[model samples]
Target: MIPRYTTPEMGEVWADTTRFGRWLEIELLATEAHAALGVVPDADAVACRERAPQTDAAFVAAVSERERITDHDVAAFVDVVQAAIGAPAGSWIHYGLTSSDVVDTALCLAMRDAGRLLVSAADTLIATVTDLATTHRDTVMIGRTHGIHAEPTTFGAKAALWALQLDRDRTRLRTATETVAVCKLSGAVGTYSNVEPAVEHHVAEALGLTAVPATQVIARDRHAELLYACASTAATCELIAVELRHLQRTEVGEVLEGFKPGQKGSSAMPHKRNPISAETISGLARVVRSNLLAALQDVALWHERDISHSSVERIIVPDSTTLVHYCLQRLNRLLGGLVVNVDRMRDNLWSSRGLVFSQPVLLALVAAGRSRDDAYRIVQRNALRSWEEGVDFRQLLENDADVTLTPQQLDEAFDLARSVRNIDRVFSELHSMASR
Candidate 1:
């Protein structure tokens, strides 16, 4: 990942030094495991493990520079580590291994570590949305469909829906991460070739991973699964951002992302307060989703393997992870200090002049012995009249000859509390699910 999108903790996970260091650890573990099985000398294993810590910035840079000439990163890395060790003991390093044997295994560990960070970021986003939902549980607002007011609902309900999506996203992501957290160290064409399966198991266990039988590389599907998880998470973030953008619109004005004092929304417009964070999330989500294609395309390789997936993954993995990390952090901060307009929410509920109450009115009329079609017709007639003339829909219903609803029934139909009567039970379910 580039520095611009990287956070310190996550950045370290994908750093060249950390990457090379992981490679060293994998090689050292294999040597130690091989020593136990009499595949390598005990003295050599100890020497390599003692020298493993020598992997630092200079050594990593040396490997990077060496790759410029060798054109093979894993080979370059092996050479650098062996050179640093400077002994007959270094001869045991990377024995009986192809580049993918070490590269793919090390990559799995790096991906797993980075995945945990994404999961943590997702968990934080879930908590932030939960807080907003609980805080605004009773804050009544108009609900819309097709960008038109449809009914009354609490702002908390909207927040709860977003939380639900993230919860599902996190579940799918956790599963995918586990699937990708596997090590493959079976030689050039896999099949264990010259390396023992037990040695692979021992090394994998030492790295806190599972050993999976592979063909030169751990399956590309595993890599694609992680990318799919990221794309799914990005999809969820976009859903939330889109909702925020709609609520924060200049005309709607029901909510606003936090705009610090002196924050500029525009260069020339003095009163502009844009949904910049939400818009940012929306735009970056496209980038994350697009990476899914590259990952999926990497699934098909030439024979046992090819370098096709390698170059694409080098860009997508860190970019997708870092972008998602930035998005989660940005969104959490945006919602934490969000400005919700309770008064404006109430105002917008009536912005349609009681058309939002049409369905409830229709239901009450049906309960009052009117036919369903007759009730719908009456309600639709009143709603259209209200929309065209900006008149009160209730008065139109009151004056209608076809309407069978009494005054008390009509007023009850228009009651905002009626739309939210079952909300507490819904909130109860959300809270219970979250607790688990």
Candidate 2:
């Protein structure tokens, strides 16, 4: 993740200093657990905390050089911390824990922080979409199917749908956070050969996590669950991007990305105001979804564990979190500054020659003693003629004797107000959910 796309707060979470600091926290927790059991001196535990604040940049820089030969990140980190803490106290640093005791647990702490940031971003996005929907609750627009006007629906309804989907994404994300918030201090093959189960439990409690029931390296499935949730959330983001692209199309200019003053859309075309934000989000979604394959592949590691999953996770976890955060923040800002063309939406609603109100007319005729088949035929006939001949569907319905309804009844059938009568109910539902 580059500095440009990554926000300062989230960027810090993935920095080496921060990751090293989290690793030390996990190590200290383990030390505290050992000290409580009389495995390490209480004074040594205090010294451990004071000595190892973080793996300093100068020390990490030098230790990374050692990692080239060692071919192990956790080993290199341990060696660096040992030098900082001096011999005796440093010897008790990772007494009864394997590399994963520190690696996986510390990774959880970092992920927990990252998840909190993503949740905040998601909440902001949902609020922005909901606010926009409320403002445009009655802003009529042509609801299209296969790129052609099929019926009338409010722009608010479409935004509300996005908001609702985002809400589900939020829930999925929260579950992912909980699923991964577990730690394991089991030795090499998860046998408790060197470390006791009580030590693992105590360490987990000290680090604000739960101990895994039985596992090797904290169970890769939890990691997979989080990635799956991230990919699914990215899919929802892509759905919004697709919609924005369609609305910004030249022929259907019902909405647009905000065109800030002096913001150039293109060097060649001065008149162009592209939906770049939406397009960028759409492209980033592919990256997130593609990473999911790696996550699933991570699930089938060799026996207890393997390095196969390790390499993939180093990329996916941080990248996915950063990408999702980037997308949510960008999307929220885009929606907040969205340029809605209410008049254009109303104009496009009628561009299809009143055919949008066809369903209401068809159902009205069915209710007025006409067979469903007969009513469908009457409405479809008039709709097709209006579409082909550029005539009003309502006028054709009024003239057709098959449509036994009076002029007033026909007028009521074509009313846009009637089409969106349930909008209030929908908005109320969203408002209630958002408040919670």
Candidate 3:
């Protein structure tokens, strides 16, 4: 992943030093397990454990240089660690174990850590959206269908919808993390021909992972699911960003991405204030979504194992996780400082001159003994006249003799408060789902 989108904490999780440290820990744990089974000397296991403290930056550097000569990463790592531990302990370091046993298990540790960071980012974003919904629970706005005014709605209801989706994203991220939190130390072909099953279990327990069936490596389905979760969450963030971008349009202007002091929206246009943050998020989301296809493609490999998935995974896993974390954090900040124009929302709601209240007026006519077809004609006639002539719809309806609604019924039909009466119910349902 590029430095521009990588958070420091997530970057560290996939760092070379961290990967090497995990690799060495798995090696030592397997050695100790062998000692417990009386397959290796206890003193050699102790020496291996003592040597772990020395496996730091210098150790990682040596492994890198060795890889240049050996042309194989895991082999180079084992060679360097074995030389560091020396003699009797060095002989037992990689005994009865294959390279995938250490490499695949260590990769799980890295992915598990990265998954936690993504989950935490999702939590922060959910909180920000929930607060927005709660704060604007009564802020009314126009609801549009096909870019035409349809009814009166609250901005709070829009935000509550987003919060509910974000809650689902959080659940998916947690589940994906759990799905990949597994270790597979089974030897080549996954039959444990040389390495015992107990060694795999011991390493898995020490690393707080579950030992699962495998063929040279843990199944790619688990990793595919993790990427899918990231992609799904990114798509959700994009959904929010696209809406904010539309709201920030000059014609709409119901909301704006918070612009910091001295921030320039455009170099050539001085009066411009753009939704750049939301646009950036929308762009990054595409990358995360595309990575999911690569993960899905990795699910099929030749026979028991092949290196085809390895190269692709080396790119997708870290990059997908980093991009997701960055996008979620950016979205949280964008919403936290979002400037909602409540007064403008009100102006926009009534911009159509009472046309949004046509539904209630139509229903009132039906209740007053007018046929459904007759009521539709009466409402549509006045609505079209009001739409084209810039006259208030209610006034037009009043002048129309075909409209049988009484004065009290007309007032009730155009009531903005009545249109949003069920907003509280939606919020109650949202809160209930959140608590669960």
Best by lDDT: 3
Model 2, position 22, has a per-residue lDDT of 78
Sliding window of 10 residues with minimal summed lDDT for model 1: 49-58
Model 3 clash number: 0
List the candidates' TM-scores in order: 0.97, 0.96, 0.96
Candidates' C-alpha lDDT: 0.88, 0.85, 0.90
In model 1, pairs of residues that clash are none
Q: Write the per-residue lDDT of candidate 2 for residues 1-436, one digit (tens) a residue.
A: 7676778878888888888877877788888888888889999998898898456787668678879988888888788888789878988877877887788888887787788888889999999999999899888888889988887889998999899999999998999988898888888888989888888898788778888855567777888888888898899999999999999898888889998889999999999899999999999999999999898888887777777887788889999988998999999988998999999998888888788888888888888989999999989998889989999878887788788998788788888888888878878878887889
Ranking by lDDT: 3, 1, 2
- Residue 208, model 2, lDDT: 81
lDDT per residue (tens digit) for residues 1-436 in model 1? 6677688888988888888888888898888888999988898889888876566788878988999999988888888888877689887889888989888888888889888998999899899999999999999999999998989999998898888888888887888889989998889899887889988999888989999988888899998999999999998899989998999988999999888878998999988989999999999999999999999999999889989899898899989988888888889999998999999999999888888888889889899898899888878978888989999999888898888778899889999899999888768867876888
> lDDT, candidate 3, residue 178?
94
Best by the TM-score measure: 1
